[model samples]
Target: MELPLDSPADQLLLAGDQVLLVGSSYGGRPLAASRGTAPGGDAVGRIAPGPEVPKLVLRTVDISDPAAPHITATLEVEGAAVDTRVVGGIARVVVRSQPASLDFVYPSGPSSEQRAAEINRQIVEDSTIDHWLPSYALEAGGQQSAGRTVACDQVHRPASFSGFSLLSVLTVDLAAGLSAGAGAGVLADGQRVYASPENLYVALDRYEDVPVPETAAPETIPATTVPTPTAAPPASTAIHKFSITGAEPAAYLASGTVDGLLLNDFSMSEHEGVLRVATTVGAGRWGNAVADDGAPVSESFVTTFAQDGEQLAQLGQVGGLGLGEQIFGVRFLGAVGYVVTFRQTDPLYTIDLADPANPAVRGELEILGYSAYLHPLGDGRLLGVGQDATAEGVRTGAQVSLFDVADPADPQRLSQLTLPDGWTSAEHDRHAFLWWAAAGLAVLPVEGATVSADGSAVAPFSGVVGIGVEGDQLAERGRFGHPAQDPTCPPGPEPRLVPSDDGGPEAAAVPAPPATALPTTVAPSPALGGDEAGAGTSSVGGGSSSGVAPAVVDSPWCQPFEPPISRSLVIGEVLYTLSDAGLQANDLQSLATLGWAPFA
Candidate 1:
C-alpha cells in the first residue's frame, strides 16, 4: 500500500510486526528528499517514513529443526517500494514535513502522480545543477591544449526529457579571441546534435529561450532568444569521475574470481584533437585463459581508447596476464597527452600519445595491492591511490603515492603514505564504508591544484585521482573493517569470506581490525608536483582561445560507480560499452555524455 505523504515516498518503514525500509540502493542509502503530494496543497519535504505499518499481508512457513530450520512470519506490500530492501540492518534515518502554512503555494491540489510528475519535470529542467566553465590559459602558435580557454560563446544546457537527462550543447569556434560561429544540438541518451563547421559555436540555454514562431500558442520555446550564455567560474567547475576499482583479479587464483564495478570502470576525456577512454576487464565467463591452454591463452586486458568522434585507438592497458583486471582506473594526465591507468595490484601504466596515431605505454610504476585513483602532478609525476580493506569484503583505506614518470616508459614509484582516516561527521566512522565490499578511494587534491575563485582551473592539467584497482595487496596496507570502526569486523574468533548476498554457516566470522583515513594536508615537494617543466597550452572547454594563462586542470572527483549492463571498452579518449543493450560514447571528464553512434 502507498503511504500517504507529501509525494511519492522513496522509502517506507513498517514496524510492529515485521519492520522493513526501502530506499535507493546506490551507496546503500536513499536520496536526501523525495517530494510528494498529500491530499492537500503544494508541498516539499525531506524523505522519511516512521515505524508505522499502513498495511501488511502475513505469510507463515511450516518447518522443523529449531536451529537449522524454523517457521517465520513474512509480510508483502503493494506498489513501488524503495529500491532498497534491508531489514534490521538499517543505518540512519531522516524525515521532513512540509509546513502547513506553505499550502498557499499550490491552488490546485496536485495528485500523488502529478506531484511525482512535477518533481521529475523540475529535475529535468535543472540544466545548471552544477554546470561551470573550467579555467584556461594561452600559449604560442595557433595550436593550444583543449582545456586552455572557454569558447567565447560556448554553452552547456543539461535538461531532462522523458526519463533521460539531455544536454542541449552548443560551442563557438574562436579564431584568436573572436567567435568563428556557433553550432547547437541536443545530447540525450547517447545522441549528439551540433552546428556546422563555419558556425563553430552554438549557444545553449539561450537557444532554449528563443521564442517559437507565432502559431496561436507555441507548445515549445523557439530556437532563438535564449539568455546570453554566462561563463562558468573556475571555482564552480570541479572535477568528478571514477579513477579506480577494488578486488584485484591478480589476487584471485585459478579458482579465484571477483565481480565488482568498484575498480577498473571505463571513462573518457578529450584532448587537443582526440577523445580518450580507459576501463578494466577481469574474469567473466571467458575472462582469462588457464596456463596450459594450447591457444594464445588470451588474457583479459583493461584498456582505454581515444578517437575524433569516429575512428578509435587503444591507448592503455593494465594487469594483462595477472589474475586481476587491467586498466582499472584511468585519468587524462594533461600537458603530456597521456592516459594513466591504475593497476589492480602493482605497477601502474601511463599511455603517452605525444604521437596520437601511435599512442604507446609510456610509464609504469610498482606500488601496493591496487590503485584507487591517480592524479597527474602536471610536471611528470602522478598522485596515486592505495586502498585499505573494509569488513564488508571491500578493500578500504586511503594512501597517497607519488610516481615520477618523467620517462613514461621508466616511471618510478616514489613515496607512499597511508592517509589518516575518519568519517566526515561525528556520526560517521573515521571512514564511511557505505557499500558492501566497497573500499572508498576518491582523492580531493588541495592547494597546488590550481583553479580560479570560480573553480575552473583548466590548464595543462594535474593533481587529481579517480577510483578502483586491485585487492590482493590492499590487505598489506591496511585490514578491511577494523573492529575499532566496526565491531562486526571480527566474527566470533574466526574469519571467512561471507557470500555478498547472505551470511552462511561455512562462512567463519572474524574479528574486525582497526581502520583509518589519510590526512588531507601534505608537504609540497617535487614528487607532489611534476618536474618543473613548461605548463604547456590549455583550454577551458576545447580548442584554441586567447586571454588565458597556462594552468593545470585538477583531476575530476570520483562519483558513485554505477556498473553499466554490458562489456565496456576504453581506447584513448573514446569509450565503447558492448552490451546486449548496444554501444555508446561516454564523457571521461564530468561523465556528462556527449552522444552515441550505432554500429553493426
Candidate 2:
C-alpha cells in the first residue's frame, strides 16, 4: 500500500485497516484545521503554514483499497513527534517541544543578558503547566476535536531543572479514534525510545548549566575557562517509563536516572518485569572525551532497574565494559545480553542478565569492524549490520556478519560479507532491516555510490538487498530498486524542506547533475551522542532559552539520499520494499519484479 506523505516519516505502523505515518518535525500549514496551544503559550485556533512554528504530523491512511489508499485522519500537533508504539488498539506517541509563543526580548550582548534572562524567568514562572505541554488538533471522519491541555496532575517533573523541553506521550485508540485519547507530559527532553508490549522507555541526556557567580558581571566572566569545580562531570541520562499493557491511556509508571547516555532505543530492554539499560559514561555526550595526551577516555556500562513505587531505582550495574571506547550496539535477549564497543577493533561482549541484580560479562569476541545494529538469527546465531572498517579504524563499507552465540563463553564470527562502498538505512533504524526466518532471508535497504577517481562523476544505486541465511554463511541473493525519475539528477546534499509560499512544503534546493550521485565511499554515522545546534534569534519578542533549537538537527551525512529505501516486509511469497519514492513488490524467491506503486 502506498500514499503520499508530504513530510518525511520517522516511523510507520500498520494496523488492521489503516497505515499510520508519523514525522518528527514538519513545516507546512496544518493538513486540516488545528486547535492547539501555539508555541508561544497562546491558543492556536487554526495553524497556518510556516517553517517558524515547528509541527508534528500524524496521518492515518485507510489501505482497505490497496489500489487507491487515502488518508482518513490527521492530527497536526505543535511539537516534534519523537517516536511511537502501538499496543493492541492504541498508539502512544512521544513528542518533545516547548511553548515558544511567549515574546521575550533578545539580549543585546552581555549588557542585556541579565535583563533578558530575568524577563525569561518571569515569563516561565507566570506561565501555567499547559504552556509546557504539547497541544494538538484531531480531524477524523468529518469530526474535529477541540483538544484539552495536559493536566498538571498528569505531568512529571524532575527534582532538578532539566531544561525547558517538555516531553508528552499522547495516546490514540486505534478503533475508537483520537477523540477518546489524551496525553501526559514529562518535564524533560528525550530522544531515544524503546517499547515492549507492556512498557515504553524514553532516554535523553541531561545538561549541566555552569552557574555564574551572582556577584560577577556578565562581561567579567571568563568565556572559555571554567570558574571552579571543573572536574569532568559524568554524562547522565534520564529515563521515563510508561505502561502500555492496556487499551487505556498510557500511564506514566516511573522515571529513573543513569550515569551515561544511550546509543539508541536498542540500549534498553525489558524482561521479567525488569528493565536493562546500556550507556557510555565519562564523555561529553558523543563519547569524545579525551585525556591530556589526546586519547579517548570514555567507558561503557550496563545497568538494571526495577519499579519502586512511582520511581525506577537502580538495582545492579556492570561497568568498565569498554574502557577508552564507546558503545556501538546493545541487545538484551531474555536472560542474556550483548554489547558491542568499537574504537580500532570491535569487542562483542556477552553479558549474563539472568540475575538482574548481578549482571556480568561472560565472554567477548574481537573483530575488525563494528555492528551498530544486531538481530538474533534463530537458535543461537546473531546477525550484525554496520560499517566494515580496516584495522586502522577507517571504515570501508557496510558489513554483515553472522555470529555463533550458542556458546556464550566463546562467541565466534561464523561468516561475513562486506560491501566495499555501501551504506544502509538499517544502521540507524532497525525497522529498515527485515528478518524472515521462514525463508532463511534477511533483507535490508542498502546503497553504494562509486565516485570516479577524479570525483567528477559517480554511479549511485540503492535497493532492497536480499541475503540468504544459509547453514553458516550470509550471501547476497539479489537486489532491486525503484525506477529512476525521468532524466535523473545527480545526488549531492539531501534537500531540506522549507515552508512554501502557499503554506505547503518544498525543497530548499536540489542537486543539479549529469545523472550521478555524490555519496562518499564511507557512510556517515553520528556515534551515540549528537551535536546540539545553536538556536538563532526567533521573532523579536520570544524570550531567552538555553541550548535548545526549535527542532532537532539532522545527522552529519552530507550526500543527498534520493528516497533511500527505509523498510522491507514479507507477505507470504512477495517481498515489499518501501521508501519515500514509492512501494515495490518482488518475488520472494527469485527476486523477480511483481509491481510498483508510487505515492500520489
Candidate 3:
C-alpha cells in the first residue's frame, strides 16, 4: 500500500514490520535567517537569493497489515537524502546539505552596476578557502547565529580546495527508535558511495579549470602568432574510507586520490578487507589534447588497497588497460576482477587481485561490443546485459552474452543473443535483472520495435523476457507482456544483425557463426508440478497456479514519459516486479503473472 507524504520519497527500506522512508521537504527560509553567510561561501553561483531550505525527513512506517500502512514516527534534519542502507537493526543514510545563506544577498539601494559589483564582491568573499573548509562559523553582522556547520576535524580534506559540497551520514536505530548524530565526516559534493559490512567508501571526482594567462607580446608581433595555452588534464577521483561500527561512524580512515574518474557505483568492490577500484583515466574533458611528455593517457586501471587498522594502504596498481577506451563495466568475484572498456572494440580485461601488493592483468579478450552490466552465474560463467555493436563500435540493440571465465588467461563468450531493435532495463540498472539459479532462468524487462514489410515501424511492445541457461547455451523461454497476450502463440520475426567490419587477429580468436533467427512460437512449460492446461495465459486478477502470462500493449518508439520498471526480485518459486503501476508476482517457472497489487 502507498503511504502518502507531503514530500517526495527518496528512499525506502523494509525490515520486518518496520518501514523507513526518507523524503526531501522544501520550505521557505526565515527572514532573519537569510542575512548570514552559509557554511561554504557562495561558490555555487548565479542562483535565486534566499532560496528555500531542503530538509530530509525520515518517516518510520508500521506495515503490519498488508492493506494499510501508517506512519509511526518522523525525524527531520537539514539536507537532501542521497542514499540509504539498512543492516541488522540500524539504518545509515547519506545526506547532502547547503548553507542557508548560500544564495546572494544584495544591498537594498544600489544601481545596477553597483549591485553587480556588490554581488561579485560577495561571491569572492564567500569563495574563500575558509568557507570551503569545514568548521567555519555561520555569522552575520559579527553575531553568532544558529546555522548548519560541518565539523572539519571529522572529515578528510584535500590538499587544495575548490567549491563546496557538504556530505553527512545519519545513523538511525530502528529497534531503539533513536537518531544518532549527523555522520562523522564531511565530503566533497557529488560522491558515489559503496559499502561493505564493516566499512564504507566514498568516491569524489574533482575537476578544476586551469586559467590560461595572457601573453604580452611586442607591438611588432602579430596577434595570430601567439600560441594558445594547453588544456588542463583530466579530472581525478578521491576515495575515502570510513568505519561503520562505532558509537558514531568513525572519521575517514584513509584517503587517496586516483588519477581518473569512476564510471559508476559498480566500478568499486571490496573483498576480504581489500578494495579494488577500476577507473578510466586521462580522457581529458572536452576532447583536450594530451601531452606527449610520457604522461598518462586514456586508459583504465585496477588499483588495490589493503585495510590496516584505520588506514587504507595502497598495495599495487595496474594501469594502461584498454588504451584510448573508456571503462563501461567492472565486477569483482573474490580475487578475480573483470573490466569492460570500449571505443572501437570491447576489451574484457581479467585482473587478478589475489596478491594485492602485485596486482596484474591475467587476460584480455576483444569483442565487437561492450557489456555495461555484468552478473556472476555461480560457476565460472558470467551473464552480461548490454548493447550489441558492430566492430566499429556502433551500438545496435540489447544483447545478452554468456561468458565462460574458467580459464582467466583465455575467457570465451560461449553464447550471445541480441535483439536488433530492442533495449533492456538491465543494461543501465542491474536491479532490473533477476536470476533464479535453481530454475536456470534469468529474466529482464525488454522493449522492442519492428519494421513491417511496408517499411513503416510498428508500435513497440514492452515485456519481460525469460532466458533459460543450460550448460553453455542460452534459450529464449518466451516473452511475457502485460495484459496477458497469447502464450501459445509465437513472437514476430527477429530483427536483422549488422555485419562487423573488423577482421583483425583479435577478432579471429572466436569467430561467431552466422546469426540464427529465433523461433516465432514457444511451447508451454509449466512449473515443476503445475498443470499444462492452466499455463496458456492469465492477467493480474485471473491466473491459475501454473502461471499467469503478461498482457501485450503497443507503445511508441520514443516513449520519454513511459513509467519505468524499477525493480525485480525472485523469492522461492515466485518472482516480484515493481514499477510505477504497482507490484506484480509471477510464477518463476511458467513466466505467468500470479497476482498484482496496485498502489493505494
Which is the leading candidate under TM-score? Answer: 2
Number of backbone collisions per candidate, in order?
115, 13, 8
Q: Model 1 over residues 114-159: C-alpha lDDT tens digits? A: 5645654564455332222222222223433323122324323232
For residues 1-600, could you state the per-residue lDDT of candidate 3 as single tens digits? 456688877777777887777787777654443343322221122444244667777777778897898776666666667676565567777766654454554432112335545665777577754444223222223343333334556655544442356666667776544343445655455468887777777777877544323243233345355334354455888776767774455455766667788888888888888888997776655433234563435778988888665455678999879876788888989999999988767889899998988899999888888898999997799998888899877988778899999999999999987766778878877768888888998888877624221334544535566788988998776554433222233343445444446744332233343333322223343333344432432322111211222233232221122234567788777776766755666777766656555453
TM-scores for all candidates? 0.29, 0.75, 0.73
Clashing pairs in 3: 481-550, 481-551, 482-551, 483-551, 484-550, 484-551, 548-592, 548-593
C-alpha lDDT of residue 116 in model 2: 57
Once superposed on the true structure, which residue ranges of model 3 sit more than 4 Å away at CA? 30-50, 102-163, 178-182, 213-232, 246-250, 284-297, 306-313, 449-459, 484-564
* Least accurate 10 contiguous residues by lDDT in model 1: 248-257
lDDT of 2: 0.71
Query: Can you write out model 2's per-residue Cα lDDT over 1-600, one digit (the tens) per residue?
Result: 446567777666777877777875555433444443323232324322344567778788777888999888888788887878777767888888766554444442334455556666787688875666667788889988855436567787765555577788888766554453667777878888888889988888875644556566545555565655333455788888888778767777778888878888889999999999998886664346457676657888999999998688999999878777788988889989999998878999999989999999999999998998999977999999998889988998888899999989999999997666788878897888999988999988768734221233334545666788899977777655654432233354555566666776554554332334332322121211222111111111112111112222233333343456788888888787777766766667876556555565
Model 2, C-alpha of 213: deviation from truth (Å):
10
Pairwise TM-score winner, candidates 2 and 3: 2
Which regions of candidate 1 fall more than 4 Å away from where they truly are? 1-266, 281-324, 335-344, 388-396, 419-600
